[model samples]
Target chain A: MIKVYKELNNILLVNLNIKEASLENGDAFKAEVIKLFDKYHKSIAINMSAVEYIDSSFLGSIVSVFKHLISFQADVVLVGLSKDITNLFALTRLDKVFKIYNSFDEITNQ
Target chain B: MAQLASKQFLLPNTRQSIKASVQEVLDFVINSLPAGVNTEGISFKIEVIIIELLTNGIKHAGTIETFLDVTINEDNINIDKKDFGNRFHPGNITSLLVYDVGHKELLTKDGLHSMYAVVESDTQIRFVCEEENGDEVLDVSNLMEHFGLLIITKSSDTFTYEYDVDTGLNTFSVIIDLN
Candidate 1:
């Protein structure tokens, strides 16, 4: 299941709990991400600590959400990561794409 | 530094073969790294690099006989792929290395391109176009979109690009710091 919450008008927090962020989940998640972006006036932050695995289509989903938010001058931040996941980011050069922080405090402080 | 065992696999430069090989390669190493991490970022970058490099090897290197080698030990991975289709002019056997040092300073371009998208228990990430390589090969399509290498910049924490026009192959390497 994918959870979306809004905080402080500018913050949108997304929590995903699933083995794979596959097509079914992606469709549902996409709809909500759009909704949250439209309703909020601040940047969005997606909490991915629960996500165990991600694929190409999944990556695209996140990129789309970020692109959507950035067009509105809002940004998304990622916090906490495991090594394998980090390797994927590095391999795809996606490590260069997103704004990732070590902890929740890092994202909040930034 | 966790003792990372280095393993190399070489195969004929084929598109189908390369993609499958890459998936298998990542599965073993990535699984052993950590749990809370998001697979999204790595999957994306791995797809891009594997596709581009394998395609290049099949098309440019013409190494139907020699195998592409990927060496992994911990965060540092060195992919040494040799091809005969070298744009190196002579059509002799050429060698290229795709290296992912897995260090910091991933984005060699500017802005946040070096920051890779990661998914953990608390942190979710969004890969932006602003963080990209100074020299983007995939940029042939969009002002920001890269044909091959650009896709990878968004997948990791560090970036290293080395291509000898003298040799027929190009290697795009990236290093991501997993928190």
Candidate 2:
């Protein structure tokens, strides 16, 4: 489950509350994000402070969501990844694809 | 050197069991580690590696049942997982991809001849492949698309695999340094 908040300039901020984003919930997570994107939230920033770890399936879901949003000319950003998760992104070279921020304030203040 | 502790479990086929297995392994690792080890980082890496390996076993092999063994000594954490499923060859990731696509040309040249190659070399060939006309190709997208094996190779200190075609047993072993 995710908490959705709207910031100025129509940036949609979604906070993921899950402890582990793995295969068990990855599909549902992707579906929920797709629903938000379908609602026309063009600029989405996911806050992943609570997510400690993610498996390939979860990462695949994120990639799927990014691909889906790209067709509609929307963009997605990720923020607040823990050290291990950040290393994962770096290992997969996804850090090049997604704009990652350190904090929600950093995303909003910019 | 005698192992400080050892534990083993039969892995269930269901994906739901993956989470439980991860937790079980984490608990064992945390409890077995000697004092002064960097528990937090090692725990995270172990979790990620275990999940990736188990998920691959379940997804690709259709392994109805398997066994996982975890052992810890003063210096290393050893993991051995065995599955009774399709014969698996730990080879160049590109070769696997080509095989998946029903192309046989690259399997012989780029692919590891056997699982022994993976262990003997102490490295799984990855991110290198050939085109149809004998041209070398490097596809970053292919590497990113198949990140599971990359994660496994990057996280573990020593990773190897063995397969018995006659018995249809795939054994993957990893040694993670605890120092």
Candidate 3:
């Protein structure tokens, strides 16, 4: 469900290659990202362009990752969220907690 | 106003099954809509409602089988779910608050967007969204876990849960008003 696209300037770029992020793959997704974060010890940017929908279980895993990274003073950002997905974040009030970018270029260029 | 479509599905209490069932229901709801209806807004909300309802049964209630009923009306959508699982413990819920995160305040009442939890008895608890209002701050600090119920209540116009002790049945009714 996740692909390690590349690492640029110490920032890990990962792509979530799933149309729906739910309980079925949430645990695996969390473990993969945790492993990547442990190995790199750097900031991570998750590209969620492929995710059309997400359930609470899946969103919980993302929250876990954010809390984990925040504890260490590292950063975790999201990019390429669909309008509905963006609405989901806003609904949960997580839009204030996570740094979300409209596109990959926005993060890469900055 | 008028009934447009109605369907039901019996699914096992597994993550994979729940995920697939949600997709199937979304497809059915979309396909059954009238020709001029735009599903861009309501599709995601329906997916969230079903996923949360089924996930709750599997995770907390240890349910083996979940039955889902989807009824789409002219002005709203109603989802009815049933399963035999452990009774709910409403005492564990510390607080139930629906905040408009964008505006940084609680929403009192809107079209199908009121939220509150009521404990009728030891064997019965209801989460109703009718005409209640609050002015609490938008706090997401301790909302990491056990928020499936919140998501369901927030997404739907009205959500009511009733567990029958006599028959050991848990019934969850959710209604989403369309714009």
Candidate 4:
């Protein structure tokens, strides 16, 4: 299950409430985010703090969604990636492509 | 080299089963490591690689069951994952990730630069492009369906795969250094 919250300044925060993000629920997660975007949420922040790990398929879904949102003039940011998850982004060189933050405060401040 | 600890697990191909198996392997690796060795980074990389490889096996290979064998020694940790599924035929594993890049583009400086970002070392990666008659060609469109192979290659110190067509068994082996 995923939790969605609307923060100040119309920022949408979607908490990925899954332990492991893999092929099983990657598509569903993408679908939910697409729904949010379709509803005119220009800014979305995904909270991956609860997620302990993710496979390449899950990561690919995130990238696909990022591209789709960009076409719509919407933006998505990832927050609270664990040390290992951060390492994965760095290894894949996706850190250069996405806007990532350590915490909600960082995103809100920016 | 001497063997310190070894364990094996057989699990169903379901995502839930894979999750439990990964956790079990991670716990075994953490507990088996010698004292005074930092386990945080190793554990994380092991977990990531395990998830990526197992998930690919389940999803792409159409595997019904999988086996995980882990052996930890003073020098390195060895992981062997076997699945009864379709044979994987990609000559170079890293190509599974960057297969979308055209051959012409791959020859250019920018293409090589982008490839370096994903693969840290050129020596460690291998791309098997064949020459048919006179022209060099690589047919890897079917291989690009999955990107987990790239992650598996990058996360391990050494990686290899073998598919026994007769037995219909696919095995992926990875070694991670302890030092």
Instruction: Name the best candidate (by DockQ).
Output: 3
Chain B of candidate 3 versus the native chain B: what TM-score?
0.73
Name the runs in model 1 displaced over 4 angstroms: B1-132, B135-179
lDDT (10s digit) by residue, model 2, range B1-179: 65899999887866778888888889989999888999988887888888988888877778777788999988899888888886565444432422332233322231111111222332222222221231344322232334565566667777766655567667778888887
> Would you list the C-alpha lDDT of every candidate in the order shown?
0.52, 0.72, 0.75, 0.71
TM-score leaderboard ranking: 3, 4, 2, 1
Going through the candidates in the order shown, the clash numbers are 47, 0, 0, 0
Q: What is the TM-score of chain A alone in each candidate?
A: 0.82, 0.95, 0.95, 0.93
State in Å the error of residue B115, model 4.
7.2
* Candidate 4 per-residue lDDT over residues A43-103, each given as its tens digit: 7899899998688888878877887786777777899998888998886656766799998
Better of 1 and 3 by TM-score: 3
Which candidate gets the maximum TM-score versus the true structure?
3
The lDDT of model 2 is 0.72
Predicted structure 2, TM vs. truth: 0.75
List the candidates' TM-scores in order.
0.43, 0.75, 0.78, 0.77
How is the predicted docking of candidate 3 categorized under the CAPRI scheme?
acceptable
Candidate 4: tens digits of C-alpha lDDT, residues B1-179: 88999988887877877778788889999999877677888977788888877887776678688888999998999998888787664533433333333222121111101122222232122322221231333221212224576676667777766555568767778898888
Instruction: Report the alpha-carbon TM-score of model 1 versus the true structure.
Output: 0.43
lDDT of 3: 0.75
